[model samples]
Target chain A: MSRIKAVDILAGGFVVLIGVLAIVESTSFDMGTSRRIGPGYFPFYVGVLMVLLGLVIAVENLWTRTASDFGWSLPPMRSPFLILAAVAAFAVMIERFGMFPSIFVAVFLGSLADTNTSIWQKLTISVAVPAVCVAIFKYGLSLNVDVIRWRP
Target chain B: MSDFASNLALGFSVAFSWQAMWYCFVGVTLGTFIGVLPGIGALAAIALLLPLTFGMEPAHALIMLAGIYYGSNYGGSTASILLNLPGTPSSAVTCIEGYPMSQQGRAGVALFMTAIASFIGSICGMLIMAIFSPPIAALAFSFSAPEFFSLMVLGMVAASTLASGSPIKGLAMIGLGLILGMVGRDLYSGLLRFSYGVDQLYEGLPLVAVALGIFGLPEVIKNAGQITGRTVEARSISFASMWPTRDDWRRSWGAMFRGTGLGSFFGALPGTGGLLASFMSYATERRVAKDPSRFGKGAIEGIAGPEAANNAAVQTAFIPTLTLGIPGDIVMAIMLGALTIHGIQPGVSVINNHPDLFWGLLVSFLFGNLMLLILNIPLIGLWVRILAIPYWVLYPFIIAFICIGVYSVSNSVVDLYVLMFFGVLGILMNILRFEPAPLVLGLILGPMLEENLRRSLTLYRGSYTVFLTRPISALFIGIAVLILAWTIYGMFRARARRRAALAAGGE
Candidate 1:
């Protein structure tokens, strides 16, 4: 099969699986009395229709010669990966240090995803932006938040 | 109607306060900042700040949030034309043709046209909102279950006409999305439909998780490999001029007006949303333009029409949400969630009971759009310069910001995990050429569909004909039939042409 067709087939299969799960779950419900249709009624129909659509797509993929313009290419993943890691670390520290310190650290570390930046410059920006934000949001406006939790 | 006018006066009184004006300014500025950044959307920005809003008056909070929405719409186009990356869905159509203009070194023209179109569209939509709101709001209050169901059906069917490459594929995607929309507990029975016994499954899919994963993560991966790569020749981004020339204005003004009409109506339609607005604006401009072939190439009209339609749709979408309590889009839904949390129920009665909120919100929306237009134009230079930053320096910061933003939504680690999973899913979907826009539409519209459909079905009592027997419902069904017939005929004709071509080749 052509790559595009193959991709379609795979996606269709995943969708079908999801449809089947929806159908089974909907069926598990009582669907209510004649005068009042249960919550499952609409979902049941939606699930069935989705499965049918997925089947149609799968069949079309099997029958047709898929188009040629289908591939995934890009620049690199290192910086993206590092940025993701920094965010994950920030999330980890958020409850401990609060929104103020955490966002700064994350943005600063994230800026480092570009290798050319000096460490001192990154640190300066990282600390400064968050500090200013804390003052504006916390002290000046009295928008409530824990600014210096661990320090106190 | 007199009550509405009086209430509106009250709202303006509150909104015109210095505190409110400053809040609006802050919101728009922050909104523009985030909008300039690729992959960071208004939803995420609002979600992060939702915590802060917990302490403020509802009107002040909503006005600020409204500013962010309009500001982001203005901001996203800058990145789209300059870097081929749309900051928001409103700007997606801009990239369809605007990016090519940038490649040809007319990025200045594209940027200038977009700003003008957006401003004009905003004013037109706001005018429409002001003039027709009383009547529209009154009409919306009468919408029954069947009407809502029909509206959703029309939206999903109309959605099929969006993509250009393959109409059938788009329909299939829409169907698949609608089915995904059915997942989770049946709202009436309290019965789980597809949870597979997982607790999180009970809530079904998180729209934010899905959106961030689908739109945000994939773009990151695509740009990841290029972090160190600098391919494009560094052309000087135009910082000198902000306005379009008179000739440019003459060409675009008609499109801008037509786009406002289309966008305002589409915005008022339940489930149709901004995606339809963007696509329809582009198609309408392409059809109406003197030179149709200029579309998808560096045509300034391409930028103008869709940008106008997008901003107009953003403004008009509030009509349904405020009057009928039916959210016209996902942002409206989130806004609804915020209002509901504050014990505020929206409807005709809201105009009488909370005049402060009613007029304040309406007036704030006006000032917010004006603020967005004023603040955004000068910052276009700053946004253009950011496009010059290398991918290596840009991608990591993007990923980090998204992570922090996602975590801040609920301050949950599980949310971060969900974000990562969806990001990977988003990347895979991109690689596979599956468009995630329909998936988002499906997810956002899923709950509403289930609620309305079940309500209609219960009223009919197993007769299925209520959809046809009811006047509004019948009209929708008839419309759906006509659309289907036309689509099928077109497909048949295309098939016949292909077969004849094959026969000629064989001979």
Candidate 2:
């Protein structure tokens, strides 16, 4: 199969899985009648619609050939992972270490995502970003968060 | 006339306040800053800044946010003209002619004309809003649950079909969004539907976290290291050289007016926005031009028309948002979300309840456009410099801001986790070629859709025919049906054409 077809199948399969899950979860609720619809009514109907749509999308490639390149190319994982990690770090550290240190750590980690940056450039950005953030969020915006806290 | 004059007086008085004016300035300046940069759109910018508005009055907050919406429209064309990068999605059409114009060293003229076009579009759209909104609001006042339900259905259908990409994928995304929106407590049954043991989700997903994760994170990931290292030459823009020639002016004036008209029509539609309006304007301009060959080669009308269309769409988008309480686009959805957060309900009654908000916002559009015109023309150098800022320096701060912004919303760690989750989902959606805009719309409108559905059914004693019985509701549903049928027909025709081509090639 072509790469584009593979992508379509994968996407359609994922959507179908979500639909099945929704349908299964919704069945646990009372499936009330059309008159006094239960909580499951909307989810159940929407799930069925989703399943139909997914099937159609999956089979669409069989009948029609498209010239546009829909080939799956791997996105650079480094930046996405590191940026996500940076967010996670801030989430984990903000309460324990406080805003300033958490922000500094997050910026430092995020700055590493760009492989093109020099160590000195990363360091400068890490320091500069947090300082400006502290000025803006803490001093300027007056957000009710601790700038620095040693206690967990 | 007297009532109109009095309303205008009230609007001017409220909008002219020092506090309102300052925030307007702040919002437009920040909007221009982000709009000049590629990748970060007004949706993401509004999501990022939503946390900061917690302290302000809802009226001022809305004015500022409204300023950002249209200000970004003005600023979005800059990068399109100079770098072939559309600063916002609506500006994508501008890049066709704009980049060519820049290549021919008419970048300054293109920038000037876009600003002027944007100004004219915004003014015309705002006037239409002022003149027409009252009647529209009055008409919407009679709409009940059935009408609302039908309107939302039409909106979803329109949004999915009209948006760029396959209609099927768009529908699937909307379905997914509707499912995701079911994560909170069920209002009718008092049962928590999908919260999975987390009490933080009782109020449903944190919109800021979801938006930032879905829109902002993916952007930061995609553009990392790409935006930096390019320097815009400062010598390119001379104030005296920015003026367009007489011939350019003559061609652009009519195009701008026509663009505004197209934008106003599309913008006032509940589901569509500036992106559709801009593309339509571009298509219309191309069709009407005496020599269509000049379009992709620095045609002034190409830039003027679409820029005007987008700006006009930005202004008129508020019509449905404020009157009908249905958002005209994703940004308006967020704006409505902001209104809800501030304990203000948006709908027909909003005009009656808060004339100051409705009128003041209208007046602010006038002032904000004036401010944007000044900011865009003379200070082009500052924005160009902003474009030169390295991504390594920029994305980190964006990361920090996203983290803090999400955290500030509820002071909950769960929201941060939600942000991370949506970020991953967003990247996955990107890979699958799904448009996130419809999903966001679905998420915003999902609960409302369900509420109205249940209410209408209950009111009519479970009769499904109530939807078709009401004239307005029936009209909306009929339109939805027609659009869906037309789209399916188009899809089938295209498929048949493709098959024929394939068979011919084989023979």
Candidate 3:
């Protein structure tokens, strides 16, 4: 079997795409002279180096083994999905509902990432965490965030 | 000697204040609690606490933050000794001997000795920092744009190459970080570079958000439900149980001093830090042992050397950050960002501009180490119980804290989105086997490097040879080149050997 792993291809392709994006974007910015180089100059050069390095990573993986054998599949997404959703939920809610509700929803969604927890445990945590947080951040620290404003 | 005495007096005066002492106590206590937990690390803990320090005086804020950094080192060995898990990355070396010692039913002695060694290491490292920083700061005054640029290059190269993982991947991550660093308004041209209509990003990528997203969230994502470490046996570590035998005492002192020496040297380097020092100390101890077989089998020197080494490295790691404004690692980089957020510019001028701040931090280390020594020895039982706090209970609080902390940075919701973006990016990078340390370093150093490069080119009329013509700049670039060559050569040799092995196996 070929030693090349899915990780190397994904990583290399993504990096090269970033390099191309950088190089293409620099075209809109002014590329001044070497003595008075513009914003584009540094990134453009960095993009070139990135492309070279990315190519090395992609090609080098073809005949050599990676540190771990991840095989040919995407990584599992259970934790990443739940955890990211938790953060996203907070971002959407924080300004509208303020700190307490936002933290409440965020903690609830985050607690779901660990499937080992019972429903009661999650509920208790969802309630208790926000209370403590409100007490600490809003009451004690006097952070600018609101606890339960209904601005929306 | 008198000058040193007076400076220390100034330090004590600042540190001995009620407010400073209170914050310092809070920081170390919080630091120990965070460090004793498995699946979290000192880097994430520091980032989590950074926002809370925003309202304080810069000196008090830094004193607390520095307390967290070193106090965590003292608490880090707890998990390594009691369970086989390393609570912090630098303490991973402690696992080699520490776990074995615990298995042999000598857990208390191991804990006690580590506290003693860590105390010695920290005190010695602080002294070294006091003696060396002024001279280094003075020397840095002579540096210009080219020298700074070359030194940054050297730092970047060393950081990406010497750190574990594929050197190519590490370099690629740095490239990505440099691009990320350019995501705001161009300072000289007054034009936005890569913000893409995000108004909040005009200043730059929020350092706290990116740091949390990259280092903090990724750790949570990877280890969320899986960190049920080995159940620690209830080791009742009373004062009598904690005492080392006379033979144990004999073997440890020499190793502690030697490890302190190695750690002090490595910690002052711009890119390496406690992790490398601890590992190198472990290797040195094994090499010098009368019977090398005793290592990894509860050899007292094994624990003594590395615990001392990592703690010492923690103290000296501040030297480069506080003096030259170059971080020894990601944690130091965050500390630098803290100073910047507090309106204190970090550079050679830092020491001269703010002696009270510098000396106050030094004296606080003295107090913080003593605090850790107290907390780690007599209070060993309390931490053992703390280690039992399951991962499910812990990570949700971490998520809440990360969100709140990032929001508190500017009271802006946009940073929350930035947190989400980097959180996803960090996960992808992890799956790709890319190390995040070098990228963070690159992000931190990117602006300074680009600015210096532009200035040097403009000053020397675009003569590329100016980097080579300047003596110190040339030396820095030369070291960078040598490191690059050595890494490439090492990779090739490893590849060739692997190929030969495959051929011999009739593959």
Output the number of the lDDT-best candidate.
2
Q: What are the TM-scores, per candidate, against the unseen true structure?
A: 0.80, 0.98, 0.97
Off by over 4 Å in 1: A62-152, B1-4, B43-52, B80-86, B92-110, B160-210, B225-244, B273-302, B325-359, B378-380, B386-397, B484-494, B500-507
Cα deviation of B18, candidate 1, in Å: 2.7
- Cα error of candidate 3 at position B38, Å: 1.4
* Candidate 3 regions with alpha-carbon error over 4 angstroms: A1-4, A62-74
Backbone clash pairs for candidate 1 read A75-B225, A75-B226, A76-B224, A76-B225, A76-B226, A77-B224, B11-B359, B11-B360, B227-B392
Docking class of 2: medium
**lDDT tens digits, residue span B1-507, model 2:** 999999999999989999999989988998998898887889999999998898899889999988888888888899888888899999999999999988888888999999999999999999999998988888888999999999999988999988888788889988998988888888888777777788879889999999999999999988887676666766648888889999999999989999999999999898899999999999999999999988788999999999999999988989988988888988998998899888888767788788999999999998898999999999887887777776677788889889999999989989999999999999998888888998998888899899899999889999999999999999999999999999888888888998788799996
Tens digits of lDDT, candidate 3, B380-447: 89999898887888888889999998899888889999999999999888877789988888888888
Q: Which candidate is the best by TM-score?
A: 2
Per-candidate RMSD, Å: 4.9, 1.3, 1.7
Query: What is the fraction of true interface contacts found in candidate 2?
Result: 0.75
* Candidate 1, CAPRI quality class derived from DockQ: acceptable
Interface RMSD of each: 4.3, 1.3, 1.2
Winner by DockQ: 2
